[model samples]
Target: MTASTTRRTAATKSRIVAVGAIAVAGTMLLTGCGDQTNDGEAKETKAAAAPLADKLPQAIRDKGVIKVGSDIAYAPMEFMDANNQPAGVDIDLGKELGKVLGVEFKFENATFDQLVLGMNSGRHDIVMSSMTDTKERQQGASKDATGGADFVNYFKAGSAILTQKGNPKGIKNLDDLCGLTVAAQRGTANEDLLKTQQKKCGAKKIKEFISDQDSDSITQLQTKRADAVITDFPVALYNELEGGGGKLFEVVGDQIDAAPYGIAVSKKNPELRDAIKAAVQKIIDGGTYGEVLKKWKAESGAIETATVNAGK
Candidate 1:
């Protein structure tokens, strides 16, 4: 359910533009009182009058954009559509956040494992991939020394088992993964889960073929390089419904370890983090949040209210 702390193989290959906060914290921010009806200036006026605009730190308000880091490959959460534009539940929800904050929530695609690292390095303002908000990530529980992030909890999801079509090898659940070769994205919660399950496998410890992206993991499953793929519930379901009309894969059992998906904001930018927390609540209260979930057929993961740092 979490993106791997993906490290880009080459720093220069990153698509992100360095978006450090607008260097000045003294910029005057507007809050719900600007207007311009002239055809030439209408757009500018509306943005200036945005209700939550002032909640952001003046540095970000002046910049007018929140850079987001995302893997852009998990369907129903984030993925490249047929049009090659970013499209999915997270993209739609990010648009909603942009409207309320009166700023652009710009998504910068990178490998799943490197997203949080990017955010910490000032390459992005936040991360909105379907990242599970576990305490470890919130604490940067790794060798990376950038401290970590605080999560604005939004949606909920769980882990699931995905196998090739026809339930080959009779794989039925996590227990069935024993003595089998499985594919998973490196540095993800799924990979950690696999390691946990491997201990139970004893002498038959499951072999793993880890990849930089889940799509590559799926390729492993497809080519018989791996027996199963561990992934989020929505991802498992999405591929079942749309992977050639369910011919490519199947979900074997019920989901496990349900957890919240969070928007990762650097601890250094608490104002932006709290602003986003409020904005997400606004969407849930107004009901647009539910509509986006339904649009992606992910209504099951919807929550009644937004919370902060609730991940276990």
Candidate 2:
């Protein structure tokens, strides 16, 4: 797998701010739970116990908080909001999962490159970044893998091509990129797909970036450094709708390589994995799942069931 860097400092700062705020909030929420007044007040203060709590590992139940590793740069999925708060589909879903597990979900921001490493190192209990569940990732075959991670698939996504508004280069599909310059985040399924497609169609110049920080690959397209950027369908659409102010980029072909985006867990933590799978299903059954997706305008990616290690 190719290694690349993400966006610049400003974006990184924003994510840090969001993670800090989330951490503070989680601490406060947990602290506030200990002081109950009267019987009525105690009842009101008490959070509904999760039926799945007994299923969680003893360590996690004792800790009362699940430390999550995430790359918060992916907007509409996981990103910083205007007030420097963590807000997005993944954040909301993780929070709901925490509630269902009767624990606080604390998000820690890291670069896309650091998440898997952090998870394997036990720096984080789980990973809620918008990571795609591919065979390579599931097998931990990348440069960063100490042990491969398992996935609890919760959302769906597909690869898409993004170009300048009106598609000046007239690129209609991946085939058209055969001899053109393309930009993609290194170590991603999209990059791998591009490489495979490039081989099949002769050769094309693929400009790989260190991270999918929007600034790098999108900048490449804006400056004509590359003819196109191949990324997740929702990401490309979100950039066009929100990031670019609706005037910078446009989606160029039907979404391809559609797959589920999974909540990654260490293969060593099957107990936690089963607990999360149940928690996600609870969220979906309770309708919180749909609400979160709708809030981010990502309802199209919502899956009916949360399955463990279901990635292809």
Candidate 3:
């Protein structure tokens, strides 16, 4: 039992202690890792189980952003302001609508011709352009208004002709364009109306203009390439007013056809439709609608509020 025996016993005890401490630390780390993995899996499961629509509204509410779409070419209704931001009656209406729904309005710029297409393609949640509630457009093409009754009408309008100041060509009506060139934006009801007149009334030689909102059609008039330009009554009137009213252009006769401006929504989604209709009604009730029209100097027209469940 000498000095050698004592040293050997001490060394053996130290090694055993070290091994035990290492094992305990390893076990604790493994337990901690396992708990973290379990917590993450539970969170994922809860998220996956939630319904998309139920989750979407909350996300929108939390973010305070409502993505809105519009063709910014139309004036007095919806257009880009000098600051390059969205402005107009429709733009103002959209902001109010978003507020009613408890969200911030974020406008996405698009062409007047592509607004509806963009909505149907799921690129936007709402379209605030001066869209007419027609049966054909409701069903995504020119046809019957069978499924179009679901939309909510915000304004009413038709078509009108914008001609050079004083009607120099004597282009008083659709009849004057028998063989003369007439310009209308492509994909618009104006284009359709002109084509129909050409066939039924013999007003042939119509000129189809692409990007009709950028003063290009007016350019056609200035250069004498087009005898006249056909567009929505509001737009035609605005052009005449901004273009020096009677000094640069004039609107001849009354608007063609009868239509109402409406905001389009998916026919299958009645809830969304109801929500939008409610927002629009709130604007009208709050007197914001009239204020917007006055700000843009838009022609006052008949406004009939449709019930949320009326057409549905």
Model 2, range 46-103, lDDT digits (tens) per residue? Answer: 3346767777887887667899988777777877889988878889998898877777
10 residues in a row with least lDDT, candidate 3: 47-56
lDDT for model 1, please. Answer: 0.83
lDDT of each: 0.83, 0.80, 0.68
Mark the regions of model 3 whose C-alpha exceeds 4 Å error after superposition: 1-59, 143-150, 201-204, 207-214, 307-312
| Clashing pairs for predicted structure model 3, backbone only | 135-145
Best candidate according to lDDT: 1
| Per-model TM against the reference | 0.84, 0.81, 0.73
Error of 3 at 25 (Å): 26
Instruction: Give per-residue CA lDDT, model 3, range 208-278, as digits (tens).
Output: 55444645676787677887888888888888888754478889987787577777665765666666777
User: Which prediction has the highest TM-score against the true structure?
Assistant: 1
Q: Whose lDDT is higher: candidate 2's or candidate 3's?
A: 2
The TM-score between candidate 3 and the true structure equals 0.73
